[model samples]
Target chain A: MGLVANAGDSRAAVVDRPGAVAVAAVLGYLVLDLVVKLSGISVFFLGMQVLGGSLELGSLLSMVIDGLLVGLAVGLAGIGLSMTYSILDFANFAHGDTVTAGAFLGWVAAYIAAGLGTGAPIAELFMLNSGRQLSTVSTFVPVLLGLVVAGVGSVGVTLLVDRLTYRPMRAAGNISLLIASIGVALAMRYLIAFVFGTQTSGVASGGLRITFFGTVSMTDNEVTLLVVSLLLMLAVHLLLQRTKLGKAMRAMADNEDLARVTGIPTERVIRLTWILGGGLAGVGGYLLVLESGTISFNFGWILLLLIFAAVIVGGIGSIYGAMAGGVLIGLVDSLALIWLPSGLTRAAAFLVLIVVLLLRPSGIFGGVTTA
Target chain B: MSQRATVSAEVTLPDPSERLLAIRNLDAGYGDLQVLSDVHMDVADEEYVVIVGPNGAGKSTVMKSVFGLTTYMGGEVVFDGTDISERNPDEIIYEGISYVPQTGNVFGSLSVRENLEMGAYILDEVPEDRIEDVYERFPILRERSEQDAGTLSGGQQQMLAMGRALMLDPDLLLLDEPSAGLAPDLVEDMFDRIDRINDDGTAILMVEQNAKEALRRCDRGYVLVQGQNRYEDDGSVLLNDEQVRQDFLGG
Candidate 1:
């Protein structure tokens, strides 16, 4: 009884744990030291890597700019994945392929528009098999048309997929739906490979580059991607926050049965969910290839893991969280190149995801299903 | 004008014998588990009906079956001369029936205004006058129109749920446990608001746990036990019935 009384509060043992204290001390010390170094006047450390390394104010700002551009693309792609998870109550493994579908569809349309009757065979143009530079400069009209076709084509593909596959198996539960999505993903990947072939090809032709600050030039490709992605994201935000359809989406996410009972037309809402999710995913794919200058059948499948990482870290079902999480993932993936090998940067970002999930299992914006 | 006439001409006034909602020999359940058996009930035009019973007596299931939310095994649900027994909820909405579930009736993440907007989803445009009437009916909601429904107090959320259902100005409104989580003082206010809605000519079919209070306000009442009808009488008659008072109302 005396020993029991001497135990103090129930948390006494945990508080006295030496390992926890050491980790906390190290993390705290690192943060404080970094803060001191950034102040630049302190000069507390002997080495340059500890004090500054190659990260100058100019370079850091440039790095932030670079990170943000790619981050916006990641965020834009993550929105559709987040929407599907929240509204449909399942993770669509095929979403990445949907992005690829949009990108390829848009590219084909661009190729046909630019190369039609200009000494290039229609077959080669449609297949995108030839080595052609279809850039913003050489194919402005076709590129803009491609963007439109990207949005339209993906919408068509998604709606068809929903009608053929998802709609029928909706009541089969999330696990079955998830497994079904994996099948869809494989089918889509191989189909694209079948059509476009397994070869990696360059799509966009490079245009002008404008220097922003010294040595930090904004390529036309980056600017175009940035502007288009940001505008779409803004449109999505406005649609969700200020429109009737958006509210219905949110309501369905909250409770499908209540939504139906309240005359919200739950089935119609589900259809709309697929439409928007598929549409955004298509645009995301189109933008990814436009920015990266390369297109492959499996590019989207490869990028799916990173996009999923962003969605999970941002809070699985939250659109805004997806965007923020995407940017954070992008930045981490970019900035990790400073400390680790370029090949290991993706691994670092994923490790960060594991750590964050350990600390906040619900994620940065979880528990709020405002789709 | 011709198109409008053509659209409106299809509908005619219903016969007087046809009640707003008529449930006969309803057998419903979730999956294979039968929760209600041979449930029979009726609500006339503008009539207020209340179903009261003990826990797991399938009081809510009866309401759910009427709304086509439960699996129908047998019998039929006839609403406004239409055998809506086989109809789904989306089709039933066009029949002018709105149901508010006990829990999760309102979208917690959506703002009060957005939740209300979602209620009028079938309409092409926002009905401003109806929104104003709803605001007048519950002024507290107007004050917190932009606030998230989740952030509201229990009483406010209950009001918002009722308001959302009322957005359609439904012919028949199904309410399950309207006063379940309310503050003691707010229960009467909720009842009074329901009375106002009923007075405005909207038929109400409610399932409540508070038998005595529910009986006091409703026009007619049904006592259900073990998924079967125990008694059916005028609210005052059941309140006064010695058997009902001792068994269900705990007098």
Candidate 2:
């Protein structure tokens, strides 16, 4: 008992060092935040101070805290997302689209439910019923419904891609597999555009806001997105770590031929992998739409670079990397807008990706090394 | 070699009995390359049959063809009264024949117990005591029940492969090079286990490179050269035969 306590103390001390470092980092960010705020170069500074920083500790701390939180989130998301790619050995280019689709579905469902109560037509409720307010229960109902709908969509697309593209190109080798994935990406892009149109559509209806610590305030939409993403991530984490199916999935990913000869039913395991991967992608898309308050054909496509950057930076096959990568990218993109031009923030995420790849090609977490 | 053969010709032939597995006029190969031709052999019930040949003499090919892993152009493999020449490997396994391949035969990533469980994957009900019985035979396996098969030594892996085959409770077990790459002691122990398996009522059709040792422990044996059956006799007769010893038995 004493030894365990000592070990726990050491671990806690290690954790505290990072926390202290984060505090120092945030303080440094606050200083930068103040310079931007005082210069008044852009009206965006007002929003930054309002949305991004703390007053007493300065903008440096705020920025650092922001970076750290974003890093942690990206790492977590990256870990979750990479499990799919690492296990399946397939790059799901349509994953971002799946997330957007889920968010869009949630938005549509919420709008419809709001509309039904107001006795408006379905089209008007979805398109222009901006005044209808939903109860908390009603607000969450769409999220659940959206998740299921998006999950189904993700699975369908994954199966379709497997049957139509992956299975055939697998024999053709890696280059062909890559080309097929590109083809799938293009098809998904055009299909989404054809169905949803190429314009940004507002999904969030009310100006719901909540304040935390007198400085950090979040909208209901943002809060929902964060909470749902975290919950989904947790569920996936448990699924991968605890279940028999999850063990089978990991075993299959580690060595497929071994799994097959061991009578693991490779086909079933493959199908389940696709389902889980697609479903997670769907949830990610839904969160994207909710947080952004808009959906367009190119939205997911535009976000693909950021998502890939997150997945790669965290680790190719490591699930923890995906989660960490997502939040890190989000926070970096958010904070990079403080210094660089808006157009350059997206490029900054990619830049981080390239630099990380150069430094550690296997990612922050190690990927499977092919002998 | 000729003088050695001439010195030991006074061996009598033993009568053949009820056939457990019979291969006739077998012509099998991989993609236009004829490896085995007109191969004829039979294993009787409760008998241990060993095939001895030099490397690349199509010994493994014979085992593979019987296990339905190789493509055969012309052949009939009757196992326990069923014609199984065209059957799939899994079907052959289900028809009471278990095959242990020469390389990568067991699941390396799985625990020893899991590998054994997989052996009985085709069966709806694998008796719990079968695992205990196998453990009793291989106490080392029981000690490392949860250890991955990859972590085991070569001899232990061979034992695990044999034990896995026994899990299915198959009537016939096909082993390809059971004694290959083993320490001399392990080889002798493996031969003894083969004898014990035969004693336990499972017909073993093994392809071995250890000609003298394998033949000495088997009930019957076959000598193959260039994929054709060159000689067939009781194990003891073949072990002492002058011509057989000179031509193929490494005399």
Best by TM-score: 1
Model 2 Cα lDDT, one tens digit per residue, B1-251: 22221212353322223477888778999878989987877887877999887778898898889887678799788887788888867567777888777777665655788667767765565557888888988889999999877789999998998888888777888988998889988898888888888898999999998899888888878888888776777778888888787778767
Interface RMSD of each: 1.6, 5.0
Q: Give me the runs in candidate 1 sitting further than 4 Å from their true place.
A: A1-51, A127-129, B1-18
Give the per-residue lDDT of model 2 (tens digit) for A59-142.
Answer: 534555545444443443344346657666766665655555545555567677656666677876655236454433347775
Q: What is the lDDT of residue B70 in candidate 2?
A: 79
Candidate 1 lDDT by residue in tens digits, B1-251: 11111112343424424777888878999999999988788899899999998899999999888888889899888988889887888788889998888998789889898888888888899888878989999999999999989899999999999898889899999999999989899999999999999999999999998889989999989999999877887888888887788888887
Residue lDDT tens for model 1, A61-170: 66676778778888888998998998899999998899899999999998899897689999998888667876676678988898889988999999999899989988
How good is the docking of model 1, by CAPRI class? medium
Give the distance in Å from residue A91's predicted Cα in candidate 1 to where it truly belongs. Answer: 0.5
Whole-model lDDT per candidate: 0.84, 0.69
The model with the greatest lDDT is 1
